[model samples]
Target: MNKYERIKAALNFEEVDRVPISLWMHLSENDINPKSLAESQIEQTRKYDFDFIKLMPFGLYCVEDWGAQVQYYSKSNQPPIVKKPGIESIEDWGKLKVLPAIYGTYGKQLQLAEHVSRKVGGETPFVQTIFSPLTVARKLAGDRLLLDMKENPAIVKQALEVITETTINFVKANVNAGVDGFFFATQCASEELLTEEEYKIFGVPYDLKVIESYNKETFFNIAHIHGDKIMFDLVANYPVNCLNWHDRWISPSLAEARKRTDKCLLGGVREAPYFDGNNKKIRDSLLIDGTVVEIGNHVKESIDSVDGKGLILGPGCVIDQQTPERSLYAARRSVYTGAHTLV
Candidate 1:
């Protein structure tokens, strides 16, 4: 099957020739320079034969657009931090300026996606990443937002409503730009950060609203849970076609997740400790075998133990900038080989 067919089938929880695969890489200078990050991503997908390519433009863009100071870091690390929470007080919420969706960081990503889709000519699926409403609220308010959730519950809810509306608009813009789908990542809604009750009250409702707007043919929405293993139930219940999370670090395993929901599962391998070049001690690190065969074997094991028809082999999270190409290629090899057995 072609890349588009493979991903479409996986998202619908249908059988395909093999499990589809995607790589989540940051829009860093390494991938962005020379050919532009989007162009480079397409080149990499074509070169390695990945089913999907995820574009995670730095998160600071949204925060910066809200008037926070941001500092771009050296190429070695992820993008710079949005120095202060953009919304300082409840009063700031009144003055809260909603920037145009196409004016800030997200717009740049859309441009890149357009270029890639045109370049690839529908052969590959292009996906753009967006912060979940609650996640974006936390980034804009930091610990203050969490405190407000307890101290000033009303204000928090009010702010989330506004952010959720903006997020829906953002998702719509991406769909308009011809992105094949979206990777909706909820970073701060984890159990460690918020109680299940809190997630249901604040996170899930708003996310469902945002997703409901774009459940059309042009978009395959994937909900990503960045942390909080205990909250698998919350993630399973989220209104999305696919579910992705950090499977390597925390698990009832993908097999257990399969029992909870029939949504397509997009991850099981470790991205940072395994794929990142900085951490060599881990067994799956690039230094271990330096071939796709090693990485492919690991991914195959995870899929074989779960439901292969609904599995998408990928790093548990975004691949760090310095991750070896070989490690990523390993994932691609695993997809095509259709090898699911542990041996």
Candidate 2:
């Protein structure tokens, strides 16, 4: 089967010629320009012949036009950072205007996706990365969000409405750009960040709205719960067809997650060499330093978990810019060398 058919089979839990495989990382140098970014993603996808192309524009592109200040390192291996936040006080939340989905940073990424879509055509499945609405709010407000959500629930909810509406419009635009689905990441869903009750009120509702907007037109939607101690069952039960989290570092290993949700699982490789998932600082560095053999083992173990059914081999999050291409090649080739012992 081809990459597109292989991914669809995995989503349906049908037999695949081999487990579908894909991996993605940031292109620090070219991510600022849509043409360059699209070229880099296409090159990387062809180098390893990944089953899907998960478009990786600037990580903070979702919040840029909303007034969040960013600092670009201009280094080939370093992604951009939020130097200053858009929301300083509870009142600043009121200032966020619903920017057009085709303008600013968001517009640039839409162009990248459009380029990738036209290039890949229908041969390979491709997905766009989108943060949950609550995640976008947290990026804008930082730590002040917890307090605002408590003391100023109404005001916070209104801002979330703006964020959600904007995100839904973006999703619609991406679907029209010919993406198969989304890598819908929720960076604020973990226990270290929000309580179950708090997320249920703030995170889930807006997240579902952004997702439900395009679920019907997409086939490879992945609900990526981004940290440890996550509200797993809550997000896993989403209307999406797949679930992804840091299965290697966090709780509920791939075998365990398989027991709870019937959705396809998309992780095996580790993005950071040493992450305990406590939101701890790792010397301000995050990258995959694993050897090719270790990466092969990650693929081996991931396949053994679900007998290779409903699985897509990749890291829990984006891999590093400097992560060796050979490591990714190993991950993509391992599926051919090994097969799951289906029960």
Candidate 3:
């Protein structure tokens, strides 16, 4: 079956010719320019021949327009780091204003999206990465986000409204860019970061607003609950159709998650480490000679939990940039009817 047919069947919990598999990683070195990032993403997709493409827009591009001091990295494997956050104090929240999604850093991403859509429009589906409003606020304020919510909720809520508006605008722009869906990622929906009560107050309302804005037009939306101690019950009920998270590394294994939600699950291969040199690290009880992605039938076991329907074989999160090509080939081949070998 074609990519669209395969994805549609999996989304509807039907038999697939081969389970859809996609892996994403930050291409920081090429993400600085729109054309550069677009070309890099196209190249990466062709290299793996993935089932779908999740646009990697310089991990911190969302915060770049909001006064974030970003430090770009030159290494292909290294991610760009945030030098300083936008919101430093309660007063800084007052300084926040709604920005246009089609200008500045987000504009560059829009161009990247458009370029990708034009190149791979009908062949392979692509989704843009959009952080939840609360997640964007957390990325802007850093560690003090929770404290600001408690001590100065009124100001924080006001800021969130502005952020929500911007996110909604961005979602609309991406929809116009011919995106198949969005990978709606929420990094703040973790117990280590916020309590259930706190998230209900600050996270849920804003996240829904941004998601429901384009939920109708998008066909392949995935709700990604980032980090550990996740509020699975909370985000599992989001309007999105697909579920992605740190599955085996955190709570609620495939069996448990299937019992809770019927959203097409997107994980199986444990993310291989970033092997730059010969520092072989043990992961998933496998001795990696730096050339494998979950070298076992782990994919089969994950699919068996859902009876091989409504599942997409992939890494829990973005794979390490330095993960070897042979490893990715192995992961892609794991979903097919053959020995997981590189041709």
Candidate 4:
């Protein structure tokens, strides 16, 4: 089967020629320019031959237009840094006016997604990355969010409502740009960040609204629950085709996740060695400095972990830009060598 059909079969828990595979990372320098970002993503996808293209525009693009100051470095691999919180006080939350999805930073991302869509055509399944409303709010407010959410609950809820509306509009704009789906990432879902009660109130509602906007419009939607101690059971049932998290670093391994939900699982290779998960050292060594043979063996282990059904081989989060090119090539080629095991 081709990449498209292979991904569909994996999502549906049907037979696939091999497990679908993909990985993503930030192009910090190139991502600042629309054409350059498009070119970088396309070039990498073509080189590695991933099953899907998860568009990696800088993570700060969603909040910069809303009065948040950001510092961009051309020489660095790190994402653009936030200079200060957009919300300085409780009143600042009320000050956030809804920006049009087709204007400012949000509009620039829409253009980037459009460029990627037209270039890839239908050969590769591509998704636009969208941070959850709470995550965007955190980007704007930083640590003040927790204090405000507790001290000024009403005002916080009001702010999130507007954030949610703007995100829904953004999702619609991306849909118009011809994206196959969204990689909805919730960076603030960790228990260390918010309590279960808090996330149920602030995160889940808005997250569902943004995701539900694309329900009938796209089929390859993925919910990426970022960070450890995440509110897993809550986000597991999100309206998406696959669930991606730090499975290699956290509880509920891929095998355990299969019992929690029937959704396709999209993690295997850990993004790095030190993250909080089940097999940190082993996964870390493989991606960091492992031989081609070792990388291929890890790929086979990931596939077999899920019994090769409803699984897509990938890192829990984006891989580093410094990762060896040979390791990536090994990851792509491993499926071919490991395909026989699934039979």
Candidate 5:
């Protein structure tokens, strides 16, 4: 089966020729430019032959237009970092206004989606990365938003309303640009950061709003729960086909996740470390020797662990941009090599 066919079958919990594979990392150097970002992703897709393209737009773009000061270190390999929050005070949250999704960084990302869609055509699916409204609020207010959620609850809700509106507009634009679906990322849905009741009040409502905006419209929406100790049950029932989390680093292993929900699971790689100089690291109780054979063995075992159906081989989170090229190539090779053995 082709990449698209394999992914569709997997999501449906049907048999696949081989489990689909995809891995994403920040392209910090190229993300500042639309053409460069699109080109880099397209080039790498051909190089590694990933199953789908998950557009890695600089994560800060969601709140950059909201007056959040961001510092881009071109000389360094790191993605852009936020220098200051957009909402400085409780009153500032009330003063926040909705911005057009078609301007500034949002517009550039739309252009990127259009370009990639045209190039990829229907051969491969490309998903736009979107942060939940609460995640955007965190980016806008930094860690202080947590305090304001209790001290000034009303104003925080006002800001989130505007943020939800802006995010929905952007989601609409991406749909018009011909994206297959969205990779809805939620970074603030952890017990460590907020209690279950707090997330229910401030998080899930707006997330459902943005997701329900395009629920019936997209075919491959994926709910990516970022960070450990994630509130897995909170987002388990969202209108998405796949659930991606730090499964290797946290609770709810693939087998356990399947018991709670039937959505396709996308993980298995112990992403914290992909390669070693000596090619020795503990991954799924196996030692990696930085060779194609070792990588194939690892991938095959991961797929078998999940029973292969309803599984997509991928890292728990983004890999380091500095990861070795051979490691990625090995991942791709593992899929094909494993396919032959399974057949």
Candidate 6:
């Protein structure tokens, strides 16, 4: 099967020729400017013949459109910064301005997705990333948002309503721009951070609304849980066709997740402490010696246990830009080889 066909079949929860392998490459402005990262991603996928290419346009820019300040780091750094917590009080919320264009960080991401999609066309499935409404709200409300959610429930609900509406519009624009699917990432709804009740109240309902809005014959959707092992069941119940999360850190292995829901499983690799060196250095020597190989082996073992069905081998979360590309290459190769053996 071609890459597109393979991914499409996997997304539908059907057995394919083999397990589909994909990566979420979050490119920086410098990488996008030179078009090197995007091009290299396409080139590498073509060379390795992987199953899918995630067009991970950063979602932080969506908050920036609401007048939050962003700080872009060097070419190898993830860009994040102090955002103006617009919901100081309920009255301040009314003063929010709608962006004339896709301003700030999100606009840049939209431009990159357009460029990459045009270049690759229909060769591979292009999945765009967007944050859940609660995630965006937390960024806008800062630490105070959580506080408000507990103390002043009415105010937090009001803020989330506005953000959810804006998110719906943002997602609609992307779907219209030729993105094949939406990788809906919800980081703030973790069980460690928010209780199951809180997630159901604030996160799940709003996010499910957004998913229902964009879910169509042309566009697919996946709910990505970035943290909290205990929240696997909650995430699995979300109204999405696929489930991507930090499997290396969380419970419910691919087999468990497959039993929990029929949705396609999209991860099995370790994230932090694996990608981030202990001493904060950028050298592979700092990583747990043989960490990459161990992870590759883990992915292979996981797929073998599942007989390479209902799985898409990948990192549990967004791969750190500083991570050596060779590590990612090794992970993909390991998954491919393991699946071929099963065949």
On a 0 to 100 scale, what is the lDDT of residue 326 in model 5?
A: 76
lDDT of 2 at 132: 93
The full ranking of all candidates by lDDT, starting with the best, is 4, 2, 5, 3, 1, 6
Question: Model 3 over residues 199-246: C-alpha lDDT tens digits?
Answer: 999999999999899889989999999888999989999998999988
Q: List the candidate 5 regions with Cα displacement exceeding 4 Å.
A: 274-291, 337-343
Show where candidate 2 strays beyond 4 Å. Answer: 275-289, 338-343
* Ten-residue region with minimum lDDT total, candidate 5: 281-290
In angstroms, the error of model 3 at 241 is 0.4
| lDDT, model 1, position 161 | 81
| lDDT tens per residue, model 4, 206-320 | 8888888997899898999998898888998888889999888787799889989999999988776753456434345467787787777778888888889999988999888
Misplaced by over 4 Å in model 3 are: 272-296, 338-343
Local distance difference test, per candidate?
0.72, 0.85, 0.84, 0.87, 0.85, 0.68
Clash numbers, per candidate: 1, 0, 0, 4, 0, 1
- Return the top candidate by TM-score: 4
Clashes of 4: 4
Against the true structure, whose lDDT is highest? 4
Lowest lDDT 10-mer window, candidate 4? 275-284
Runs of candidate 1 with Cα error greater than 4 angstroms are 30-35, 217-219, 274-293, 338-343
At residue 77, give the lDDT of candidate 5.
62
- Report the lDDT of model 3 for residue 207: 92
Total clashing pairs in model 1: 1
1 against 3, candidate with superior lDDT: 3
What TM-score does model 4 achieve against the real structure? Answer: 0.95
